[model samples]
Target: MKADVVFINGEVLTVDKHNSRQQAVAVKENVIAAVGTNDDIKSYIGEQTEVIDLEGKSLVPGFIDSHVHLTIYGTNLLGVSCIESHIHSLEDIFTDLRKKAEETPKGEWVRAWGFDQLEINEQRFPTREELDQISTEHPILVIRTCNHMCIANSKALEIANMDEHTPDPEGGIIERDDNGQLTGKLIENAHMQMFKVASYSSEELSISMKLASDAFIKEGITSIHDAGAYGKGSETLRIMQQAVRNKDIRVRVYAIMGSLTNSHDFVHQMVQAGTVTGLGDYYFKLGPVKLFTDGSSTGPTIATRQPYTSDPKNSGIIYYSQEDLDCYLGNAHKKGFQITAHAQGDRSIEMLLDCIEKALKEYPRNDHRHRIEHAGIASPDLQQRMKELEVIPIPNPVFMYVNGDVYKEYYGERINVMYPARDYQEQGIVAAFGSDAPVTFVNPLLGIHAAVNRKSKTGQEVGEQQKVDVLEALRCYTINGAFASFDEERKGSIEAGKLADLVVLSESLLTIDSARIKDLGVELTMVDGQVLFKNEQLMRPSGVRR
Candidate 1:
């Protein structure tokens, strides 16, 4: 049979069961027609086939980002960046937002994200009063890098009807001053409420979704688990379907369905509608029922069994009680919905495990593949429990690169066990890697680099004992991610029958220095036998497009 496209003279890292490497690949229609040496695939190429000579570049299965807030990441692209690398102080944040405010229409919102108070010189969040100075004419909302908290200027708070007398919402904190006035810091559910007031329009969301899809393809990510829809799952699901039909979203998505607020009702509605995980098509599918059990590790708000070393009196935030988790998760489990939650600390991990364990006892289902998003600080005991239940842990090792110093300060020795890629490997657990985009960046190379080195950006070996090799790291981003989404048989590897979702890298990951892995560029990204992104600068002269 004639192939639709042929890639030859490439180092093809299949990341399959045997960790095999091939020299060429041929795509027929939307699936891999063959994977072997150049001679093996040359026979499949026809005159009409798009034969691209790789010139010794590296080809691997396209990255599968197991967790990402796609819409949020897209919108973040539109907002002012307050990341430490971009802005080093609160004054810098004001400068950037002020510029954005001037460009925006009065009475509209001026938004920014990716600010970490710990990284800034002030070592504190930009106050609402300070943000108000940028533009009282426009509402200002600046989300912390963790996404669990944000600071809203007076105008935005006014729009949300939040006053000095506004009590904190359940499972959230509206910080107050010594005199009991609004400090303008909204944590957890309070942040969600602010989001409701500044929510994006459908048109805006469509634009952002397209932007996010483009960014994913540029970074060689062909499949992603859209961590949240940003509102009600049912409505968001329909919007996603429409986006797919409209050709706005190019990458494959496993749309995770749940809400941070009104979660019970969301879960009930999904169950009642007979929606379960693995629903929908190859391009888009319904993923797990997700819930947030705790806050972000970088925020130092993850519910740990012990108090953070930096704050003796605080053990971080747990969003729900064990009973509540059991109730919410048990009901979904009984309904055959694959369940997952944001459990980042040992305490939160333990709490979630209890609920999963209870659910299985009541309604045992083999190969459930229930997942723990972040599973950021699983201890030995927690790891044992995860293995026993056969639950997958989707850990964002990239957190180690972006927020490792904070983790070191807050959790102390816990850094060594945090993410724990090596431990997961030894225990035979299929742990998937995620970027948690907009929290960190969306590049899978960053995650792979962090996993291999276990080093923070500042040269600190945050978790030396937890380091995994390059091939192992690649597996987590590729095959292991596919396993988490139940799409392993169809995509994830460069096997003959698998979908032709592949990425050509400027450098071979297996041969690159661990520290330099994050620097490698994507030469091309393809999905369903179609090229979505190509770096013209890196293209070989002999690589001709049909």
Candidate 2:
């Protein structure tokens, strides 16, 4: 009965199927030895074992991020800051750009991210004419926080040879001023044109992936679903594959393959090569083939059925036609590959649902569990169909706090149904939550707060009725996330024989003020019976198991 470690005298919120609670947990090697009272668990401890006394603190399953771009996060850390902390006005953006521009060698491409025009002083997008002033010599590209749109200077436009004569790609737009001149803003696939001008080096990609893994350990995120992995054709896959071989993957990852244009081709490649989900072990695994049907919710590219309230003439953009999606996703589904799509607007969601329905009827597979990422804005009919078709909705509640006002501006009264967590739960549909990091912070606690609060940056409630309790919100991040990734049996909950991956919090979220939940800190994080992070200030002194 001896164990490697024992966490004793703690309030353990075992997010088990039965919703059980325990006072102690014993770990033997990489699995949970037992979950029981402090006295009972002590029986499994040995003299050489490490014992931690929780002192009534909170211990729960480690957070599993359902979606994230770790490589992008690492690269963004190295990029220039353009968020609110660095810029509250267009002037601040220019100032930051000017600094970076001065340091860069003339003609090289200068890149940055996390800029939101809604938060800037000008309260509008900066024109290409304005960007020319920042750097007429170097190609400057500043991506918005949404990552669905970006602004490029004259040099960048010239470098890519984008002009009025250059027509917009099928799923994107090249914004122009009233005079029919390039405004330097590229929406959706139009931003892909920049790839021809600038591409990230393999070293840059590897460095960022490592940096991102380290950051996840500190954040108590034990697992992540890399939503897009094959951008450069097996390059992303090889990077993570090498990470696992070198033990650089600090956290478990389920990488979803990225496709440039045709998802059908990507799936055909996988099926032909005998590549299927769960191809790897616990540390690294191949996940679903991810495809995008639309763009970001906070941005103007979500592809709605109705025009935006703020910009009445624009109804947003849908990236794929119904016939096109069916051809791609239907083929993938027929080949036994699960699909997770990014669809933010109602029309796009409808498109995916229709395709999924047709695929199931034609292929006749059960437990397909195909997911809809961001599923940000759904119609009542869409929700009902999601339930009937067994489609999983993976939504990021943090967007409510980060861009709630912008969502409200575009949605108007339709904001009532935006991110409807309570509805999903009550309707017997399993919904998972994610941070969609690099778009927003990767803090799961903040995600929980956003779900329970449903409040905006200014503390305005976007949808009071949509709020879920703290535990349900927690389940969405942990168990439901595990379910989404098909790892519920080994991870997710604290139960006997389960993986010893857990997080210790400074306060009990159940008893704390809802507002303070977001402020709570992770004191310790354990993966496979090893402590990865321990905050000395919050952890108690070691104790003898006896």
For candidate 2, write residues 1-546 as lDDT tens digits: 798888888889898977777899999999998999988887887888788888787889989999887777777876787875757888887888888889988997677788887777788887788889988998888888877788999899988889988999878889887888888999877875565455567777788888888898888899898875324636767887788678777788888765533434565677667787778988898888767788778777888888888898988887778998888788778888888788888888899999999999999998898999888877688899999999999989998988888778888977778878988988988998888888998989999999999998799889878999998998998999899888999999999988999999888878899988889999888988888888787665663334
Between which residue pairs do clashes occur in model 2? 230-258
lDDT (0 to 1) per candidate: 0.88, 0.83
* TM-score of every candidate: 0.97, 0.95
Instruction: Look at candidate 1 and tell me the lDDT of residue 459.
Output: 91
Count steric clashes of candidate 2. 1
**Mind giving the per-residue lDDT tens digits that candidate 1 earns over 158-259?**
998998788888778899899887878999878877776687777778888899999999999999998884565566668777888788999999988777
Report clash pairs, candidate 1: none
- Model 1 lDDT at residue 158: 95
Q: What TM-score does structure 2 among the candidates reach?
A: 0.95
In model 1, which runs have C-alpha deviations exceeding 4 angstroms?
84-86
Report the lDDT of model 1 for residue 113. Answer: 88
